[model samples]
Target: MLKLKLYSIICRKYKFVQRESIRSNWMKQRKRTTSATSIANINVH
Candidate 1:
C-alpha cells in the first residue's frame, strides 16, 4: 500500500513537469512562428 501511494505521487509529479515542458516548448514555437511571419510580411510590403 505504501509503495503504491509513493508511486502514484511520483507519477503525478512527473506528469506535471512533463506538461510544463510541453507548454513552454509550445510557447517558444508560437513566438518563433509569429516573428517569422511578421518579418515575411514586412518584406512583402
Candidate 2:
C-alpha cells in the first residue's frame, strides 16, 4: 500500500545518490591517474 510505495521511492532516491557518488569517485580517480601519467612523461623527458 501507501507505505510500500513510500519505501520504494525512498529506495530509488538512495540508489540514485549512491550511483552518482560512485560515478564522481571514478571520475576523480581517472583524473588523478591521468595526471600522474603526464607527470611521469615530463620526468622522462
Backbone collision tally, model 1: 0
Tell me how far the alpha carbon of residue 11 in candidate 1 is from the true structure, in angstroms, after superposition.
0.4
Supply every candidate's count of residue pairs whose N, Cα or C atoms clash at under 3 angstroms. 0, 0
What is the C-alpha lDDT profile of model 2 across 1-45, one tens digit per residue?
A: 999999999999999999999999999998989899999999999
Model 2, runs deviating above 4 Å: 38-45
lDDT of each model, Cα atoms only? 0.98, 0.97
Best by TM-score: 2
lDDT of 1 by residue, 2-43 (tens): 999999999999999999999999999999898999999999
The most accurate candidate by lDDT is 1
Q: What is the lDDT of residue 42 in candidate 2?
A: 98
